[model samples]
Target: MKMQAEVIREGELEKRSDSLFQLWKKKLVVLTKDSLSLFPDGHKRAKGKELGFGSILKVDCVERTGKYIYFTIVTKDRKEIDFRCPDQSCWNASITMALIDFQNKRAIQDFKSRQEMEQAAGKR
Candidate 1:
């Protein structure tokens, strides 16, 4: 059964577009335990792109200006997606904490699976 992801934080964040202009577009972002969803229309019902935490390597704070805190999300494939939020929003910190939590849970699950495999082999 597929489990529903819990919402950790939801807010409006500015994402640097990959287009030639490299303009920053406002995205309605929904931060979940397992993924970050970007809604283009700033509505929950709108179709959005989901970036799973499993594929994300880390979030790096790139720059900090007086108005906004810029950060980059590096994916496993080495793709860097830039984002920014208001200085007080703490979006970077929120994503980092959630990502760490997801990674720790995955590590625990992997360790349990290895133990179970070893136990089965011993029984045989």
Candidate 2:
């Protein structure tokens, strides 16, 4: 069964390459409630890299220029990925909000599980 994730936003953003040249390339980004998918080309049908919210530590706004707002996404493995979008686009805020919502949902689930374990222990 394929899981359908709700789309929060979709737009084009420039991502800094990790290669030696560190060139910035425009990517087609699809922000979902649970993950951010980056398509190299404009075609969404192509294979893309999916960054699950579970592995995202935080999204930090690094700087803002007249043309673009720069941000970094820190992952669980401490890898930082840089991205930039037009200042008016507010991509940083969108990603941060989505990340917060995902984290809150995980926290709530953890709390409920702990409560259930406590109740079981009391019964025992």
Candidate 3:
């Protein structure tokens, strides 16, 4: 529990606001993952296996303009991400598909965890 709390606190990056999404369209979300639950659909689209921390981002998208792809990050306080990568055509669709699956799985797991906790409390 302590480790999980520490990880959540450390792993999070501040959320960007609606205005930044309006201005830029989308942003990439990365995971410092050791292993990701592989997705079948996404597996078909992969150019190659992502190795270690070399996986630049798990997903990328442009938010506002129908997801016209770009690379930038602007926090809610209007802080700009100075970091830039070489212009590359990102595989948005595949990444998006995989991320959706990941999120659904997480949601289910969270619900189950809550149920178990509630059951324990009732028994107590």
Candidate 4:
């Protein structure tokens, strides 16, 4: 089934192995404001995996060697998903920017909610 998400950037990238011995696979990658999705092919029938920003602790540019730029997506629970894209593709940078924006928006919303709750408590 197709995922229902507001698309930020969608394209193809290589998901690399997290192990010391690396392997790469081409996949269709989807970046939303709040999550990243990867599908085996550019078709709806392909099985997909989703990683939400809420669980993502950080995105790191691990290394750039030769024509590939390696990166890692670390989750709050300490899980790391590694990926690599062509140096010219800039997929890593775009994903990082979108994730940072999402986090900033969330922080502002959370701060506003806390302030409103405190004001209500003071009034009571």
TM-score of each: 0.94, 0.97, 0.35, 0.88
Tens-digit lDDT track for model 2 on 1-124?
Answer: 9788889999999999999999999999999999999999977999999999999999976699999999999999999999999989999999999999999999999999999999999998
| Best candidate, lDDT | 2
**Which ten residues in a row are the worst by lDDT in model 4?**
15-24
**Residue-by-residue lDDT tens digits, candidate 3, 1-124:** 3231111011112233346454321223343223222222233243422222222234433433342344333333443432222234343343345445555667799999999999999998
Q: Give candidate 4's root-mean-square deviation (CA, Å).
A: 2.4
lDDT of candidate 1 over 65-124, digit per residue (tens): 999999999999999999999999999999999999999999999999999999999999
Per model, state how many residue pairs clash: 0, 0, 5, 0
Measured by C-alpha RMSD in angstroms, how accurate is candidate 1?
Answer: 1.4
Q: Which candidate, 1 or 3, has the higher lDDT?
A: 1
Q: What's the TM for model 1?
A: 0.94
Model 2 ranges off by over 4 Å: none
Q: Per-prediction RMSD in angstroms?
A: 1.4, 0.8, 12.9, 2.4
Tens digits of per-residue lDDT for model 4, 1-124: 9668789888988887556777788888989988998998776478889888999988985688889888999999998888888888888898889889989999999999999999999999
Clashing pairs in 2: none
Kindly report which residue stretches of model 3 are placed more than 4 angstroms away from their true locations once superposed: 1-90
lDDT of 2: 0.95
Worst 10 residues of 2 by lDDT: 60-69
Q: Which residue pairs does candidate 3 place in steric collision? A: 25-62, 25-63, 25-64, 26-62, 26-63
